[model samples]
Target: MSKKNPKTLTVERAPDQTSEQATAEVAVNPAMNAAFVVDTYQSNILGDDVDTDALVATLRASMDKSAAGDLSGLESMLIGQATALQTIFVSLAKRAHHQQYQRHLEAFLGLALKAQAQSRATIQAVIDLKFPRQATFVKQANIAHGPQQVNNGHANGGDTVRALENQTEQIEVLEGATHGGKEMDTRATAEAARGNPAVEALATGHRPKKRGR
Candidate 1:
């Protein structure tokens, strides 16, 4: 029997082909193609002329929006977690009741209590997420350190006019009283002088001599 030498098959590659290109060319399956596709996309994104800051900002914005969406849906997730914790608590409670030893019973009960507390906390978290507490912004009031005089505007000078009128009326009344007293004194002197000369002389500021009775 003659032993035949096995022929080694040589593969031809392009002069410009890289190791990655060779690997991509050899890959036939979609999974292998997917990896290379991702690599090609990343390479395209990280090109020399690419605006790195803009790219990073865009990626950050996308991620931030996704995170915000997750937060928006967090209420349902927290409620589910609370429900699951309640189920665990119930299971633990049943196990605690069936335990024969005091230590096992205490251990299971403690675990059940912990689960119950966690469930309560999850529920509260959901409530807090859904109905967030309102922020109270207190406005700064500029208060004077000492006494401040506040002037509410005057009422159209009505008070000033009333005060002036009151002063005028007081002056007129004083003048009238003086004149009326002078007139009364003059009338009294005229009537007394008509009846007696001596009384008239005394009223006129002259000295009167005593006359024979």
Candidate 2:
């Protein structure tokens, strides 16, 4: 039987070859993807005027590093970091806080995010989590919620709950244990509450208006 050494599995690049050239060739330039990010990111995330050169450089460097890596994990790590740096630049650019200070903030954010892929991933995750959902969007779109959780998840209960959440106009729940008599809610409630045609003038949010010029 032969014993395998773990070190043998690790891949190392040749020291003589240039990393930047290899990276540029292997990885799609990050700046190309950044354009998509700029378009897709929150409307409030970026200012009209941005330091294009700096952002481009950061993206290029990130992609270059990513393409140069021998492993896919390294690629993801680089992409993640690039995205994070873009976010920072975009956010700072949105602010336009000072005379010449705008450039400094953008630079700082770019540098800070570029240095740490893990940090960028964390921040990006938080931002993703915080993004607002449309009222109709199901809360279960978040994968972190759990597999059993449905996107359009509803509260668990019987017919009574189904009525309330769905606005069924009529639903009933038994009040007592075991022998509890079924309560009739569909009785004289409507006429008593509205008084026939006396209160027909009130308008609900969606009620259509009668025509009268």
CA error at residue 204 for candidate 1, angstroms: 47
Residue lDDT tens for model 2, 1-213 = 785442221222467758775555334544745743654463466653444444555666766765785344444655676666666655554544443675786775555545455456656655554553557744544332222222335445464354445442322233322324654555444543455666565558757878898
TM-score for all models, in order of appearance: 0.37, 0.19
List RMSD in Å for every model shown: 21.7, 23.7
lDDT string for model 1 (1-213, tens) is: 873322211234689998777766646534334444544477656554433334444444545755776564456668899999999999999999999999999999999999999999999998888788999976444332234222335455676456556766777766664554653343443445556665554544455677989
Candidate 2: list runs displaced more than 4 Å: 1-30, 39-43, 70-213
Which candidate comes out best when scored by TM-score? Answer: 1
- Which residue pairs in candidate 2 have backbone atoms (N, alpha carbon, C) closer than 3 angstroms, thus clashing? none
Candidate 2 yields a Cα-based lDDT of: 0.51
Segments in model 1 whose C-alpha atoms lie over 4 Å from true places: 1-65, 68-72, 140-145, 148-213
lDDT of each: 0.65, 0.51
